[model samples]
Target: MILETRGIGKRFGSVLALRDVSMGVRAGEVTCVLGDNGAGKSTLIKILAGVHQHDAGTLLVDGREVRLTGPRDALDRGIATVYQDLAMIPLMSVWRNFFLGSEPRKGLAFDVARARRVAREELKAMGIDIRDVDQPVGTLSGGERQSVAIARAVHFGARVLILDEPTSALGVKQAGVVLRYIARARDRGLGVVFITHNPHHAYPVGDRFLLLNRGAGMGEYGKADITPQELTSLMSGGAELEELAHELRRE
Candidate 1:
């Protein structure tokens, strides 16, 4: 396993945000974290990204227990998180945004040519087809922007990629575009942590599924252990959904 959480729990003030959640992601596989709003998905991502520490249980990286001090700590450990906000400057060029902080230095000056070349090469390696490296990021479609972020993480040596709702705002075609890049990353031997509420999105590329409901775990299942219907039903609260349908039925 590349990353594993054993019975992990997180608490904020008196309210416990997560409890007894055990899940792991292996190299060259995608582990989908599926939940609706307020399902503690963000809490779990925060812990994994080193934005917050787990209050209980253990977090293991490559079988060794450790505590991350902050986001930098996680990155140094080869755990990279690309939040939904994307954190990309819209006005910046694609290549500029790709090498935002860690720009290559040539005698105390930024290497613009090298940055553009490397960014284009990295994006191509991941099979992401961005039209131009010099185009403004905001001009690209949402899925293309996400592709840049994913490619950036992979190029920078991310052993584990934690994506926060990459496809939530995209249309059907765009979502498929992003999903294709995700599979590409997995194929390249990177363990991907794909967090999304859509079972439709999760079912296709996921090797394993982690279901969270109201700050607790529903369960985790390998793809072979559960069908797509079961995954959608379980994450959407099968019994509750039925009850809701009946409650809203015409008289």
Candidate 2:
């Protein structure tokens, strides 16, 4: 396993954000974290990404206990997170944004030629097609932007890619595009932690499903053990969904 949490818990003042959450992400597999708003999904990912420290339980990286000091610490350990907003400059060129902070250096200056070539080659290697590397990132579609972010993460030696709601703002076709890239990433042997509220999106590409409600785990299930319908019900709170369904039924 690349990343695992055992009985992890976190609290903010009087509120408990997460409690007894346990999950593992393995190489070449997609571990999908499913939950609605305020389900402790964000808190969990933040802990994984090294943005927040867990107040309780153990966090293991490659079977070794480790405490992350910050995001840089997480990156040093090969855990990179691509958030929903993507953290890319919209007006910058695609290649520039790809190598935003970690540009190759030639002498005392940034190596523009090397950066552009490497960026283009990496994107193509990941099956991402871009007509021009000079085009502004804002010009690309949402899925394309997400693809770029994923490609960037892979190129930077990320062993565990934690994607935060990548398809949340995308349309059907655009979301499909991102999902294909996610599958490609998984096939290439990187452990992926896919966070999403939509079970439909997660069900297609996920190997394992972890459902959360309020601030605790509903359960974790393998693909063979849970159908898409069942996963959806679990994410929405099965009883709550049943009550809503009954309310909508005619008298």
Candidate 3:
């Protein structure tokens, strides 16, 4: 396993954000985290990404118990998170954004030629067909931006990629584009933690599913053990969807 949490719990003063949440992420596989708002999905990934520390239970990376101090600490440990916002500068060129913080340098000067070549090569390698690397990031489509972020993470040596609600804001076609890139990443042997509220988006690409509700776990199931319909029902808290179905039925 690339990453695992056992009985993990978190608290925010009087509120408990997560309790007894356990899941594992493996290399070359996608672990879909399904949840509604306030379901502790964000909290759980925050802990995994080192933005927050768990107050209870254990977090293991490569089979060793370790406390993550902050985001950089997590990155240093080969765990990288690509949040929905993506953290890319809108005005920057693709190559510049690709190596924003860790830019390659030649004797105290940025290696412009090398950076450009690498950025272009990496995107092409991932089957992303961007017209120009010189284009400003803000001009790219939402799906294109996401593809760039995923490629950046992979290029920077991320072993486990935690993506927070990656497909939430995209249209159907754009979402499909991002999903293909995710499959490409998994194919390249990166463990992908895909967090989203959409079961339709999760069901197609997920190898395993972990459902979260009200800051607690519903259960974890492999794709073979759970159907898409079952996953949607559980994610919506079962009764709520049934209630909606009854209310919407024709007279």
Candidate topping lDDT: 1
How well does model 2 score by local distance difference test?
0.95
What TM-score would every model get versus the actual structure? 0.96, 0.96, 0.95
Model 1: residue 185 alpha-carbon error in angstroms: 0.4
Between candidates 1 and 3, which one is better according to lDDT?
1
Q: Which 10-residue span in candidate 3 carries the lowest summed lDDT?
A: 235-244
In angstroms, give how far residue 186 of model 1 lies from its true place. 0.2
Worst 10 residues of 1 by lDDT: 242-251
- Lowest lDDT 10-mer window, candidate 2? 232-241
lDDT of all the models against the reference? 0.96, 0.95, 0.95
lDDT tens readout by residue for model 3, 9-63: 9999999999999999999999999999999999998999999999999999999
Question: Of the candidates numbered 1 and 2, which has the greater lDDT value?
Answer: 1
Q: Model 2: clashing residue pairs?
A: none
